[model samples]
Target: MSLMEISCIFPVTDIKKTACFYVSKLGYKAVEYLECKEAHICLYRDKTEIILLQAQTKNIFPNRELYGYGYDAYLYTDDQEKLEKEFLEKGVKIVKPLNVTDYKNKEFVIEDIDGRWIAFGLKIKD
Candidate 1:
């Protein structure tokens, strides 16, 4: 099968807050918005996209865990310092500070409102 794109569906407690956090703070663009049976919003950054679904049930997908113990996604950026500063200025909660690592890149961690950890990194070029 040919790979195309990756999309993650997240259960949000409040759609507006989630959208605002992503669009206003995280710098993602809203690609789509729908209000049908349930409110749905799609936020995108470059090729990466995430769909936020507002379900009727209080516990959406109760059987399954949304995010694992660690980070759910890793976002690569060319300027880690700038991104970190922007996020800090916006008052976004930083789970971890930006630091250089021997293994891969300069990276940091942040958590979404829903408690999903996103690892932001800048690739170390030789």
Candidate 2:
């Protein structure tokens, strides 16, 4: 079996803020907003898609724990320089700055408002 697309679901504390961040800061477009009491914002960039689900449950877990014990998502891009510049200019928190690695690519890491890790990279051409 072959995979068609991958969608990461992130539990957000504030739906509106998270939605805005994805749209304005990350440059992702909202494909559809599910009509439900609990807000579900569906966003996509090219083929990659993500769903931001506002947690209706009254669990008092920390933001990191609520989203998942570890990283809830990662976004890979071919335009590393442009992506990095845009994110930095927008004042998005950069967990790791852009750097070229021996592994054969230039990459950087940034965290969304909700603390989700987004790694942008460009493959090195020989």
Candidate 3:
């Protein structure tokens, strides 16, 4: 057997709003959009795929902070610096600025409208 692709699904308060953000702010394409009792949106960027689902029931906890966790997603990008600058210009909610971690990755964190923490980064090679 062979493993295929994977898509991360997030429970957002509003699918349309989140999709717009992903499309405009994060540079993703709306592959599918659906609204009903439960809203669902599928976004694609290059080979990456992200899905946003309108949360009906209450979540176990609020954002990652209140949940005592962090980093809902780690988005790997080759052009980290340029993308970070673009996000800043777009006034994206940055949880943290770009910095080299001990693990040696140049990375920054972005907070979505729903408070999901997404870390975007690239490897720092010596």
Candidate 4:
């Protein structure tokens, strides 16, 4: 069996605010399922999908906060410059601009409304 595309699941304190951020700032379309047993908001943009779940606590603990240094998600993209430019124009909070990492990946990191760092880029070939 082959694995398909991966989707991110975020636990946010406020689903509406987080959904708004994804829609307004990050160019995503959102649909809420608040009436369900597990309330969530599904954010979709191109091939990316993010499910925002209602957090039990007021605060979220991202991987960086727990592990000291780690991105919550890494999205592979072929056009990093264009994506970065679009995000910049849309007023998205870019924590790290597009640059080649030491690991040889050209990527840019953006901080979401809940303080989760999401990187977008692809690894360079030698």
Candidate 5:
């Protein structure tokens, strides 16, 4: 079966606050923000779209817990350095510094406003 586009839906405490972070810090635009009973917002950046849904509780995993409680998001991009620089300048908490993994992947990880682990990586060249 052929698959189309796949986007993420993250549960957050507040949609406006979370949406603002993506817009101001991560360079995402708020495509849709519904402030009804179920607060929700949709952010768009380049060809990617992320949906933030207001939830009652949070399920953020600790940095050390990399096993069962997995990362909330894992993303790949070509502009790794540019994104790292931008995130650093914005005072974003880069949990892990950019480095080459033993698996030969050059990547870094960052935590979002909702405490979700978002990892970005790029393939390393020989």
Candidate 6:
């Protein structure tokens, strides 16, 4: 068996607010399932999907906060420049601009409403 797709799950203090950020800033469609046993919001954009779960605590601890250096999520994309430009035009906070990493990945990072750093890039093949 082979894996088909993967979705990022984030625990957010306010599901509606977090979902709004993704929907407005990131241009993702949000579907609320607050009536479900596990209340959550599903964000969709292209082939990407992020599930926002209602957090028990008000504060969110992103990976970089606990690990010192790490991204909450790394999404692979074909057109880095275009995506970066689109995000910038949308008023999204780009914590890191488009740049080639030491590992040879053309990537850029954005700071989400929950302070999560998400990197979007594609590996460069020489």
Winner by TM-score:
6
Q: How do the predictions measure up, each by TM-score? A: 0.77, 0.76, 0.83, 0.96, 0.83, 0.98
Query: How do the residues 50-85 of candidate 4 rate in per-residue lDDT, one tens digit apiece?
Result: 999999998899899999999999988899999999
Best by lDDT: 6
**Model 1: colliding residue pairs:** none
Q: Which wins on TM-score, candidate 1 or candidate 2?
A: 1
The worst-scoring run of ten residues by lDDT in candidate 5 lies at 59-68
Which residue runs does candidate 2 get wrong by more than 4 Å? 37-39, 57-70, 101-105, 122-126
lDDT of each prediction vs. the true structure?
0.79, 0.76, 0.82, 0.94, 0.82, 0.95
lDDT of 6 by residue, 45-91 (tens): 99999999999997999998898989999999999999999999999
Please count the clashing residue pairs in each candidate, in the order shown: 0, 0, 0, 0, 0, 0
Indicate the TM-score of model 4. 0.96
Better of 4 and 5 by lDDT: 4
Positional deviation of residue 56's Cα in model 6 after best superposition, in angstroms: 0.6
Give the Cα RMSD of candidate 4. Answer: 0.9
* lDDT tens digits by residue: candidate 1, 1-126: 898777878877778778888998888988556656666899988777889887555653321154435567777878888988999998889988999877868999887777677888977888
Candidate 5 C-alpha lDDT tens digits along 1-126: 899787898877777888999999898989665747766788888878898887777564444475656567778888888889999999888988898888888889998887877888878888
Off by over 4 Å in 3: 33-39, 58-63
Candidate 6 global CA lDDT score: 0.95
What overall lDDT, based on C-alpha atoms, would model 1 receive against the true structure?
A: 0.79
* Per-residue lDDT of model 3, residues 1-126, tens digit only: 998888889887667887899988888998655745555788998878998887776552435667677688888888878988999898899878989998999999998767778899988878
